[model samples]
Target: MDEPRGDYWYNLVTGKVEVGAQSDWTQLIGPYASREEAEHAIEKVHERNRSWEQGEED
Candidate 1:
């Protein structure tokens, strides 16, 4: 895959941290500023879900 110029991405289908968009948009989860952020994408999603469940807003 050709590296796109942008933030890192987390490929949900492959569960991998990519330099940018490396897969279909539907299968990717980020324009995260860093690879570390992309790596924790799932955790962030769960955190948001839990916060929403508790009626919390950022």
Candidate 2:
């Protein structure tokens, strides 16, 4: 039998997405096709990370 590709998850600790058969310190939110895709998602989140912080203090 062939090994499955399995599900990929985003690694918040490493700040990079990885695919494998392991989950613990890593967060398995969902799967992404490529690292670029995952990075883009992270970037989007970061873009908004400071929005609330800045708004409240302003």
Candidate 3:
């Protein structure tokens, strides 16, 4: 099977999803593998922060 190759970006300012450098780097969240993953960028950030906090507490 063929695989898809591209980076996904979530626009913080416009609350949008982009594929492969659609907008400037400063406005984007990531480099995520899929559009769906990019769409949940905010949630992922929060989750990551929580993990970091938990780690610090340990």
Go through the candidates in order and give each one's C-alpha lDDT. 0.83, 0.61, 0.84
- Tens-digit lDDT track of model 2 for 1-58: 6323434557766666666625674455456655556556666667788787889898
- Candidates 1 and 3, the one with greater TM-score: 1
Regions of candidate 2 where Cα sits further than 4 Å from its true position: 1-8, 25-34
TM-score of 2: 0.45
TM-scores vs. true structure, each candidate: 0.76, 0.45, 0.69
TM-score of 3: 0.69
Stretch of 10 with least lDDT, candidate 2:
1-10
Show model 1 residue runs off by greater than 4 Å.
1-6, 56-58
lDDT of 2: 0.61
RMSD of 1: 4.3
Ranking by TM-score: 1, 3, 2
Model 1 per-residue lDDT tens digits across residues 1-58 = 7544458998888899988686899999979877777899989999999989888554
> If the candidates were sorted by their lDDT against the true structure, best first, what order would they fall in?
3, 1, 2
User: Which of 2 and 3 is ahead in TM-score?
Assistant: 3
